[model samples]
Target: MIEFKNVSKTFTAKEGTVHAVKDVNLTIPDGKIYGIVGYSGAGKSTIIRMLNGLEFPTTGSVTINGSEISSLKGKELREQRLKIGMVFQHFNLLWSRTVLENIEFPLEIAKVAKEERRQKAQKLVALVGLEGRENAYPSELSGGQKQRVGIARALANDPEILLSDEATSALDPQTTDEVLDLLIDINKKLNLTVVVITHEMHVIRKICDHVAVLDAGKIVEQGPVLDVFKNPQQAITKRFVNQETSSASLDDTTVVVSELLEKYPNGLIVRLTFHGDQAKLPIVSEMLRQFPDVDLSIIEGNIHQTQEGALGSLYIQLLSEHHDSLQGALEYFNTMRVETEVIKREQ
Candidate 1:
């Protein structure tokens, strides 16, 4: 387990002192995939660095298990670092080294015998699906393959924790998904604790079980991935979530809702959120069956799967001759555990 207790970091720049991170408190549980998301200058990279003792905190403590990493120095820090492995965004690999050699680099530094290192590196090569490319140098490999080599190298030490600092930002969407899937597989196979730092919401949505949203060096919100995606509390977090699921901004949603209200003055506009089993239900069909007098039109809807389960949202407008029917429909939704909000209702 990793705990950040009121951790903060500051740097002295030529422009003066800059607070990179502020009184941040976070707990990353063992054997879980956690994400830290933020845009440029949000201090997510700083947090990842602090986790592996690459950067020390200016105040408070960053504790891994029971040890405070900030206080460790020299050999102690280097020894502790072997327990945490890091994967970089740029896929830092030696161009002159082949895949097998790159993966064996860590083992070599650990003073393992040549034959033993080769055995370990070969195993990692198979683990990361680089079997046929073991002899390929970084220059001959694609971006994703390079990252695979990076991952294999990071795991050579058999570290308990892995830190990914924007590890997939440089890849295309398809390649990014592939790398993310590999990470997820490694996590389950080895029960390795993974901490990913990225600005991309898709990364968090794809594999992270938990997430923390940072803005201007402060964590605005943090929670289980499903909870945060379904019900984001901060503006920045909502923006990120909406980008992945809604594909529209909140202002855009409002404008669309307003136009629909103008076109159908008597219609009721609502936003419905469904999760897990609720997402699989034919609620709209059932609503029409029960309320034959009402008509429902979907303005926008999207459903996507997460680590937790399927989560979806729908913007709908209900047309009815009677207001009581609409009220009954909402009550039914409530009882079914479908979260609903009235976007526009007649006074």
Candidate 2:
């Protein structure tokens, strides 16, 4: 397991001192896909740097397994680094090197035999679905292929932990999903603990088992992926969750709601939130069947599948001449363990 104990970092530059990270405490379990999410300059890079021993913390300590990373030096630090592989945002491959050669670079630096490294690189090329592109150079590959090479290179040393730093920020939406799916494949096949740092929340929803939300140099929120998505507490976290919960913006949601209100002025806009197996249950159909006197219309709804489980958000307008039926439907949702919120009641 990796533990960050009261960790904080500061920089003494021309502008005096700046606290980059403030008292971050986190524990990442072994073999779990963990994500650290934040906007630009939220101390994410600092934490990654500290993980690889690139920078020492000003206070507290970072420990992985049994080693104190901040105190390691020279040979100790170098050896510890070999156990952690890092995939960069940019491909960061040697422009002159072929895909096979790039994958062999790490082993070459460690002074492994040329024949042995080449053999390992060939297997990795196939593992990352770059079998035909092994001889191709960085320039010859697409953005996604280049990242595949980067991932293959990171695994050259067969590290137990893989760190990805904005690895898909440059790719298009489809390519991003492809890359994320590849990472998930790698995680399951190797049982490697994966750490992904990015500003995008959909990335977390797609791959991470657990997530930590950073804002203004502190971890304002964190938990299992499903729990966080099901109930985001902080404003920063809600902003992130909204990115996956629905495609519509708040303004768009409001506009649709306004139109719904105009049509069904006495309707109650009920928002239903459920997680995991609740998505498969026949709660909605049952509600409709039981409440035959009421009218139910779906406004907007989506079920997002996370690495941990599934989370769904559904907005339905309930209308009836009598208010009792609307209230009865709300009570039925409560018994089904669905979180319900009345978005608007125009009675």
User: Quick one: best lDDT, which candidate?
Assistant: 1
**Tens-digit per-residue lDDT, 248-273, candidate 2:** 77668778888888877788998899
Q: Estimate each model's TM-score.
A: 0.96, 0.95
lDDT of each: 0.92, 0.91
lDDT of 2 at 39: 96
Model 1 ranges off by over 4 Å = 247-255, 344-347
Which residues of candidate 2, in runs, are more than 4 Å off? Answer: 258-266, 344-347
- Number of the top TM-score candidate: 1
Q: Lowest-lDDT window of 10 residues in candidate 1? A: 338-347
Which tens-of-lDDT digit does each residue in 232-251 have in candidate 1?
Answer: 89999988998888856667
Per the 3 Å backbone cut-off, how many clashing residue pairs does candidate 1 have?
Answer: 0
TM-score of 2: 0.95
